[model samples]
Target: MPRKGMRSLCFSSPKTLAYAISRFPSPSRSTAASLTPRPSFNESMIQQTIAAAENMIVKWNPDTSSFAKVTSLFYEDRNEAMEFIKCVNGLQKAMHLMVTENSGSDNLVRSQNLMQIAMKRLQKEFYQILSTNRAHLDPESVSARSSRASTRSSTSDYEDDGTDDDIHAAGDCISEVEHVSVTAMENLRLIAEAMISSGYGKECIKIYTIIRKSIIDEGIYKLGVEKMSLHQINKMDWEVQEIKIKNWLDAVKIAVKTLFNGERILCDHVFAASESMRESCFAEISKDGANLLFGFPELIAKSKKSPEKMFRSLDMYTAISENWPEIEFIFSFESTSAVRSQALASLIKLTESVRTMLTDFETLVQKDSSKSPVAGGGIHHLTYYVMNYLTCLADYSNILADIITDSTPPSKLHLPESYFETTDSDDTPAPALTIHLAWLLLVLLCKLDGKAKHYKDVSLSYLFLANNLQHVISKVRTSNLQYILGDEWITKNEATVRQFAANYERLGWSHVYSSLPENPTAVIPPGKAKDLFKKFNSIFEETYRKQSGWVVPDSKLRDEIKISIERKLVPIYREFYDTHRVTLGAERNLGLVVRYAPEDVGNYLSDLFYGTGSSESTSLSSSTSSSNRRQSRSR
Candidate 1:
């Protein structure tokens, strides 16, 4: 019969039970009777005895009174407990014998049904008592108690009812009861693994919480709730914390592997610890470092210290970066390439954030340019602050270079040798992101350059653009950025400055040519020379009046610009003068009406920019007319 069919026979009709029992082998009733005598009691008496035995056996079920009564009974009659164990074992054997001996009898099968129920209940109760008692009994104590019980059962009038195998089986059940703590941990591990496998990272935070609790309970980390704590301080404290964190990290690694099916877990503990230390350092430097990061010109200027407090905050970031190797070494077990790459990436992010502050400042200054003139010292110093910060970045050139190399695409890695300035032979090196940095720097300079055009005077606008452009090139040359931008880049920008000078010359001198109309006939109308000279004087006075207040700080740039203007205008003016003088009187009033020789026109053009004379003296309509005539006589 199938096991399920046989189990059903226990609850089926008596005929069915007997039929199922008869299919199995039968044992001799006489041999079982010879081993133990049959009871002389009536059926009621037998049922009563079974009930009393049930009452004596402690049920493991929480609903029963027997659950609460084992401790005292086991403490008082240890030998009696062993006798009860033997009694349950005999009941189990008797049920097996009944199934074999009385297979064809309906009455025997009914009796056997009752016996099986009693045996199962007795087995459950017996194991429950054993489990409850095992916590208090060591292996030696159990062994000693069982031996005494065995000797007492054999020597006294009681019979030895169980075989050695039955006793050993009972002992095994008792010994195998698991500890509550171990069971709880195992359950936690299984649940955590399930949670992690499902990509429930937030839920896994509970696992971390549990691990932290365990760490605290294990005394690995002290609870610092008290005011007077006993934890290690300073460097020693850090060492202790690192050790604890490493231990927790190992546990987390196993948990991550279990949950994520063997994905590598980054040691974020190292990064997290480093971030904590860095934040503390940053907080100490400036409570408002975040504001400084976005470039507060007022805070920087208002601070009484020599350079600025913002500069100190800037240094703080660099200091952390310089000392970053110490924190990076926390992951020394990881691959060097990975660690350094991560470090470089973090540094790049920091540099970009700092640069963002400068960008914000530039935006502020640009907005200010629309409302104010370009000559304020505040704007100038703010521009200097930006340049100074860019110079500071050269300190991290190697890290920046690596970042550039890693981000560059493979096809164009080796740029032309001429694109970068290097000390060695002309082998083209891999192009770097430093070139991008140079471009960004140029963009910032151009922002200020464009803002310079807001000035009312055209010459002032050129002067502003020239000064800022020169400042940009000089700052780049002095810094490591020069290697990235190359001599070719500088040469190109220098040519651009010369172009601006040429443009300015064209704008100023274009009027002079327009004043003298094309006289290709080589003749002048009567009284036309006087009208032409007056027209020329009107255009010259107007040009110099507008340009007189415009300042060019660099004397060399000023002189070069004036010479360029003169080269274009002096020859044209002289040719017009010689042609006009022949048609008019030769010596009668030729020098007086012509007004300016070539040398006098050159000297007047030189005075066009600021610092040539005082404001009243520099005006061509008033003071310059008389000075030009005296100078004309000398020429």
Candidate 2:
């Protein structure tokens, strides 16, 4: 079934693939070498809080049914505990009930409200918890300012002298560490809230300072991860897959409340960190030190089960936004435009890189093929990236079209460098195909009803690009195929690309246009013209209709192409034939102009290529049949 330019694909979800860790079982690698543990300023306060939370865990374990399973999580059976206490408050689950329980008995309801409030407070102060400690959730926090003190409250805890400030100041004297485990952070939150709800808000400063100076600076975060044995790693692998069995929404809601709590101090820190990482990445790209992508051998790795167990707090939420950008703010209830916009900006960058890759693949292929020591990377990489790029854009197409319509930028979609600037010419300034320019074109395309439709827009772009590519492909001489697909030439460090044209007879392009007779006087050689004809045949035969998948073009499309050539090229060629007479013979070759031809022609030669003038044109016209006969014989 001959067809052109269509491929029907049936894709499967990437999730079906299984993932495994590269680490060995019971591997005896030392943590000190792999982890550069740092201390937090609040280390002492946090440790104190954790110790207190551990005590609370011991006390609460027997009675706390809601968190009972969590507490026993690190153990194979029912009785063990990991070192850190986690926040299994299931915080978001409480949001609706907090607002709805307003009509109940003030004391009875308030106590419940306080517990709920305490959890909210707990998550805020503590941050994220380590999975190992998820079962024994530390109290996330205490109520903002409780009216009634806990019956078990300490007298010194509620002291109004602000004396804890001195202890907090003392935290400055301790050595610092790097990275805090979400688990350790959660322990601090529970302790701080417990103390405050017990009437010790003034003591909060000492707690924060203790954590900052000792734990944050010292890096308890790195240590917690480093502490994980091969067994723990293996356990984590199970937990990720098992999350689907639990109420995932419950976990997500809790996370949203904590991360989006609108803390001025913490928000700023997050912003600073994200911006710094972005800047560093950009600078590295500009400097051309991106070794992982280009020079190094590529790895085919899939995400592991329970991937979230290993993600940082910020990444977990942001990834949700990436997958569901349209409903992100709605689901998380984060009304801040800056936050939403930041998410969108991140999505935009991701989309742009994806766009760059999809567009520049041909160039990459050509370059890779040119290398002397070829890297035999398979089509799997290309297929994977293309499908990923398309899937992401397709999912977000509605959001993108909406944004494009509203933005003042001339184009709706922004493209990377490789799209318009096909040539990095020395004679002129690099052609302006900047990202902003591509956006202008996208904006225009978005306004078009056809392009605004799903899959239509992408297909429209593909066809348009393909058409222009055909023009460029047509202009390339068979001789210049070497220069055209540069990388492939370099890979062999040889002129193998020329073979795309050179193997015409063997490849059958030569046979397709074998009707043309020799005309050495023409600007292009008879051989070259025949090859060009072959290339035209190839665009349909070898390149398009020959794909390994489904395709069928409309009959009218083929007919229209024939009609177009009749209208455009046939008349043009007719005029050339009438005026040029395009006559030549071997007798004119042999010595002066042509190569060592007629000398070899003496060997029972049929004929040789030569040009003809006015009288020669008469002879050429009269000899057209004989000339055609000679060309057929040469064939």
Candidate 3:
């Protein structure tokens, strides 16, 4: 009897109905009942029509039998079909004792048992039809039927369930494959936790079984969703979603294994998860969970072989930022330790990928010097390289400490070390860039000018306080000896060192400026105020001259520099505040900012002085540029 307005359209013959019916209600999908055919065909007709029908059961009512054939004929031959059936049956039997539900939740074992019983009866019915019609069915049709059944068996969880397709299509709604995947993982997670909380120790096993069952039913893997599985495997739009969901699920499983001790036992549960990521059509997503299975080295190796693969990786990495809400949890403290660790680890892998991508992009850009020029003249990949590095670094930094993030320690060559270098070539002329960087770093640790001290002074001071600071400077400074020892480099430098001493003495007197105090006291560590003054006086006396002698010898020039600092620069900077600093009496203490040398200390206030934070300034800046353009036009 068919429904009033419709007939059940079977995927194939009614013989396969048992297999389809048996595999309903996948682990991830609770909506299995909706996939059943309406006014379905007779089971015997389907079995008789299919080519390889001997092993494919076409009929049987479950109320009559306890055993049913579960073999599917998708692969080929009756034996192969029987093997598939035997394997699933054995797996189901093995899974019987695997998991238990929490006290408040429904008993998973009972539910599983009931599911298996339904599966048994349905399979038996299918077995009867296939066996009876073996004489009429063709090998090709049997194979096709078997494949469809097998695909629906365990892998169908990710594939289209007939019910969802029509309903989803009617609504013009897209299936949130990724969301559903994450939800499935989360559900598994909750169930596992509840099982654990309920003192059921086999929770991991139970969750594993549930996941396995669901995956097998879908035929798409929990760990790996191959590209082969996705070529119009479902609706085109749904394919990508399926992959993403697979990725998230894969991520969850990794978290579970690493977070728990089951690290060694994969059970291939997350294999589909891995495939989901590695097999993604999008490069980034495909590469997303790759590091979990293949080391970054392999990716690096593969990327080298295939530029196309690498390009895909680059786009994927760039797109991840678009989903900040999902990733934001990456930074939270509440995330499971495993999830947080994986997030951080993923960043390191990403960094490596970016580095590799840039390396290749560099080559591509260079091979065409006759073409468009980019910045750095060389292959710097300036914009994207820095962007990739910074984004990856941010994720890495939150998980790791900031100390490692600071590139400025003795750890580098007092020599400016390249981020990476393959060879030390003597032919390469020594770049002065290293010395300047060294100087910049040195200034950060010390009070460069007595009048100016760096902000975060304590942290700043610590950079130098440790002996490594002096050691690094000394090591790097020694490298400059060839220049320093040269007649032109230092023949007069000795005299300059003496002059610096004299200059410091004259400058330190403070008596020269009647308005200024004779003694300038620095605020120091509370208990060591006296020692601080002593140290300061010595620094002005000895270090000011011999320490790192950079100033040119002109007393009047020093005074002029001081005058400029007080009169024009600082005053102009303060006036831009739009009266915001007016009521604050502490503006007097604005001198604290002056505590830092112009360079080392300017970082904190750089934006203050130059940032287009104010609307007025932005408009003025725009006008200035426009005015300059007009003048140029007139000229």
Candidate 4:
């Protein structure tokens, strides 16, 4: 017996069946007969499929379905939503078959209308699912879930033995958050694929971009990013700009690492069916926020170039540099190229600004025209400022290495080859930053050399050089500059400091050294001895009074200068005094002639570098009174 619905097609007579079969021509028939389309059993199947799809589609249509009006179809009843998606897919296929079979068929027009209604319903569901499950579909959670999914997929490929236990184990690895996110992403992808395949991609993209873009924009705002013009940034005081730069640094990390990155992941997952759709969706969602976030540095770079602003510029440079890989990957789409260009422009601008600030700082050091000398031969103000500045610069050497990689010192400033030398173990040429910093020091030293000449005394001039250079070297040795400017530089500069000290000792104390006899052991006449003692006393008092005001600010350098002077002068003076003391013993007013005892030589030398000139006269008067008392007691 025929099936219940097909009973009407059954023939009662055998002749009717034979005649119907005869009308269906063979494959060898004429072209006209061959082209004459014959209805097949598939026609009934397609009609049945369409009928089934209409029942499901009309039942859940957003306009007519009571269940869809009160509850989210996807969230509240996922099975029903799945059935609706399947029904829409079946309707689409049925419509395709109807069009192919007969272009003007009534069934084709009905399928088209049904398709529109079904799509409208699916669109509503898609929007509802996205809006209701926003927390579950957030970029961070979605990104994390995507990463775990990838990891689990790869792990299961290796670890699974096609056993139920292994499958369950893999399934158990997913957390509740992952399950929720996965369900949301899968549902979104299915609806997206159905809509896109049905030629409604623009609608899906519109909905996705609007919601995701707002989320990204809000995220950026909450992270404290703001769009400001170059004029606004330039007009801001450094203190205000500094706060903004800090906020930008923090915002950029969250924007790139979480906000933008998460958006990219979520977009890709939702539109996994079409590459073009995902790329376009991601670009539309994240481009505006990214461009504004990155454009800030370029504006700051265009601001007034000042030495103090260099570090903040470098900080902005570093934030972008560290996140460049993600920026490149996330904004790789052609539509989002503006974001990448903005980031690159900002980096280039920051680099140029940093280079300019360094040049300006070096120029400032060179043009320092403070004519008056630092009192008492102490460390100069310029030395303090430059060393402190360079010390801070050394902390960003890695970033600076990339910024000024090809930079060189100014052409007019000539530095010796030895200035660039590093330790033997380090064969790599000193980085550009190292050379740049070394040149700045050289400029400072040259400036200090010019300042040293302002002192009237030649010896004080040399003392000033020693004091300032020692300070520069001390700063280098203690900070990150030690690694940057190697030990060889420190050693060479230390020798120069010693040379300055020697020159100071020679020039400052030459008169006192010349007052002593060549050989202290020689037996000379009393008149000659009295002449020698008078000459020595006169020279010693004048030199001591002159040098007592000189200062060595560094404690180590101070003690060193004092010990050096004592080592050279004390032994010779003490030997001359002891050998010739008795020769002038009977001379009247002996205390006046031989005023200094051997022990008193060291005491006076100890007081030379303290920069206390007022105490020198009092000390000399007290010593003379005590010596006179001792001499009177002896008489």
Candidate 5:
């Protein structure tokens, strides 16, 4: 005998239900006495229950019902659908009582026939409600409604009591869109519970997975996620592949956050009675699309590794990495672990590709064999390219940190500890990206040093280093690298630029400085002074002609160099010229001998770094006008 209040026997399938019924326990004498119907329970009541259920169930059956032809049973007549569900429930209880009394009775057979009709009507209603309310039950809308409902009541706690109480409880709180969704979801839940309880879970699962899987597939297609093989990806041109990568980056966010999340919520709500069914249905619908979506990055990673392709690869890695928590939760079932594995595989492959590209970039920098020096000792082409690339790379520092955290610089490169210090904390090691960027710059500088030796004049070589280093430091300060590498690195590199400039000044101007006496105002013979002046004029003209063609591209550094020369050379020459012009006043060719005034020296120094090397007469004329202006200012 079945226990009291036991609704019905659940069977795995329709075929198994008969076998299960045949094996039903026979009542012992004491149990039989307890199992007897009360005064209210009788043969008339069972007949009435079965007859009422048959009329309603057959009237709405999709095959025979004229009303179902014109309108859906659930949508046009929700109260009828509720009453129809109650009839099914009543029939199950009556069937259970009759089976216990006499399994072979005619009334028991009639009750089984009515149960099949009720299930068919429900199956049709379930399909009708799902098909008609697609917009209301769309994953995005359903996810949103579920989110709001969960704030007040847990979405997972929904129970189908064969009533409209869930809908009524939520009617005032939700908008019309949400109300429609709640009503449809509640209907589906009722039908699903009735069918599963009556041994038709397979049929219910089939209808649900077929409809929802199509929706998911269509959503993925509309989002522009495509399926492609690795050969196709590898053979495609980078420009076209780049566009694909960008689209994937955009589409992945929508697919994970909205499309898949909504489907999961709907699956859980529809099959709340069976946890295994919920997991199975969600996995069946979502797994293939998700695997394809996440598998794209793995194909991209396996494509040709190039320095240019690294950032896009990182973009794909970041898209997956940022959304991983959601992916883990939504696809958490054991059946959907392939989706998780595929996503993780993409991240791992992208990390490897990026690390390889970084090494390739470093090697490219080290092997840059452009032996020709920049014509005017200005910034080199390699300097501009690498700094610009690294500046852009710094924009992805946080992402790159995860990629390169375990990767150390090569042992042979031997980077210094001070190179890794940050402004915020000196003791804390700099982030991997900062160290990596600093290392790349070091490689560029070392390569530049080798290229510097190509210059015939050692002084111009030093000038090249100063100009290029200044450009590097300027790039770092103006971009994201400032926050990554910090102020101490800038100060240290700036000091290097100053040191290079000092070496350039000392070596390049030694002759001019030597041409003057140790003491500019020392008393001496006029004839000896005239000889000293002639020698001074010869040396200054030659040095000025040569250095005027050397360039300092940075305006601030150029001005500083000019001011430095003026401070060292101008005032002493002016003092000496004032002392000696009177002594050599009456000598013939005195104009030819005292070739430059002190203010003329100031003017010529102004033109030193133009890289123009203008004619001597043009320089002298430009200098004379500049000298006259200075003289006017003095007066």
Candidate 6:
């Protein structure tokens, strides 16, 4: 079937084909005699002419002469060019037959070269024409010029001297070019869609790639436009260019989506499991608990590549906005919005999968923490990765905020004004995007909070919470995120950390007091003293061995926790010492029996979080004194 605007060149009819063949001028007898050595070249010349005609399907406006050029052996005659509407169609059919019948002949090779030559010529001409007449295609330029013309006419008392005829001519040129370009774009779109439908995705990719490069070239021209001032350029012109860039980006986005869609760009080996597979995993792990130890490695390995794919999906759209300001202008709710939405949706799905994987991994860590400190290390690594993901989310959300706020009628991004209360009189109220991001951060923190509870050891659990919470708080405070979350939110999280610290101290020191004798009235019984010493040694050894390996990460919080534990256990040890020192005097070694002095007990507690406790012990005492002074002053 003939393509649109090509019915006149009806190559399907025998009479039309004969007419097309007749249009090809025969070689003169004199010319043929001169080519005696190349006597069989007449058929080759006809094939080449057909190929050239086929390639001229898309004509270039810039290449045509102002005066009519004479037809040559291959060039279209001016009258025939108008007469043959489907010139490319007829020529393509003729070339196809000639190549098919004489597939390996030198004539076919010459035809191919002719076809290629026509392609390059037309492509170059198309690019030049689009570049030269760009302003004509831009609605903004037309609008701005018309506005200026109107203003001039009004000032001249509506007198007409045809001075603005050039502007009118430019408008006419723009209208004509706009029609041609629109038709060209539609044809390309159809071809691209057809390629995709036929599973020629790579071909489609190449097509869009060329389109993007061409549009970028046009953008370079647009960018070079000189303005009297930064804001002096016509808004309509900018808006027009923005639409053009967005249209191209939108097409590229679709092409990319086609490449990614329905193909498992993700390593679905981790998340998308059949019920049988899941059951088998559970059964295998249950049969030999050791299998559970290496199970997370597979999950982790599978997930490791997923974030990168997800990032690329997001970067596909974001990179366009970064490179092209015109496309960026229409990002949020305009032509590029669908592609952005698709990219964001893919990102969200990937992140949610990551969250689920981490959640399950945390469960494994909790169950394994008692058996191996390796589990704790793994959790820390996972926590760091999760933090990196959250950082990406925060940065991308800021970009979304900028886009959503600037969208037509404004997108505000579902962030309510009531969400954030202004903490300082001078501080500006947080933008909707910031508040939206703060909420996302909160959701992640809450997820981490749930994961922290998986640790069997109370101190390890508290340490996990402290490290992650402190990280979140520090990030918010250091970045622009503080304005959204506010000082109160930070204070609240700090208080939660203090609560965890208190819990850590309470659990860790619980056994210390129980080791003291109930009655050291006169001389404590030898058996009771022996039991007391043994219990004290047992608890002290256990606490130090376990907690010394755990980490708080934050120096200040670690010190505070150490000091709190010191205050609880120190006085108890001193009282117990003063009460039972004489009773335990019969022991040959008092140092071994009492185990620790009051100061030594304080030192041990100071050393509980991390091994560098001696310096911290001194700091603890100073802090205690300072705190006491502050309390006294308040009183």
Per-model TM against the reference: 0.39, 0.21, 0.22, 0.82, 0.87, 0.39
Q: How accurate locally, in lDDT, is each candidate?
A: 0.45, 0.28, 0.30, 0.77, 0.80, 0.43
Question: Per-residue lDDT for 245-314 in model 3, tens only?
Answer: 3464443333223211121112211222222221121122212232242232222223332233443343
Residue 212 error, candidate 4, Å: 0.6
The C-alpha local distance difference test score for the whole of candidate 2 amounts to 0.28
Error of 2 at 446 (Å): 28
How many times do residue backbones clash in model 4?
0
Residue 436 error, candidate 5, Å: 3.1
Worst 10 residues of 6 by lDDT: 262-271
Lowest-sum lDDT 10-residue window in model 4 = 151-160
- Pairs that collide in candidate 6 are 140-236, 140-237
Model 2 C-alpha lDDT per residue in residues 1-635, reported as the tens digit of each score: 11111111012111210010001011012223323323332334433443444443444342444554233332322122222222212111121222233212222222333333333333333332322322222112211101121212222122233333432343354322211222233234334434333223333433333333232222222222122233433445455423421322233333233212212222122122233222332222211211111111011011222222212212223343444533343223222333344444544543343334333432332232221210111112332332233333334433344333433333223343433343344464321222222332232222221221222223222322222222222222222332323342234322322232133112322332332334423576544544443343333233212211211122332233324323433344344333333332333331222211222212111121111112222221122354464565567
Residue 258 error, candidate 4, Å: 1.1
At residue 172, give the lDDT of candidate 3: 48
Clash counts for the predictions, in order: 0, 77, 53, 0, 0, 2
User: Tens digit of lDDT per residue, candidate 6, span 580-634?
Assistant: 7777787886666666666656655655554332222223221234335345435
Q: Clashes in candidate 1: how many?
A: 0
lDDT value, candidate 6, whole model = 0.43
User: Candidates ranked by lDDT, best first?
Assistant: 5, 4, 1, 6, 3, 2
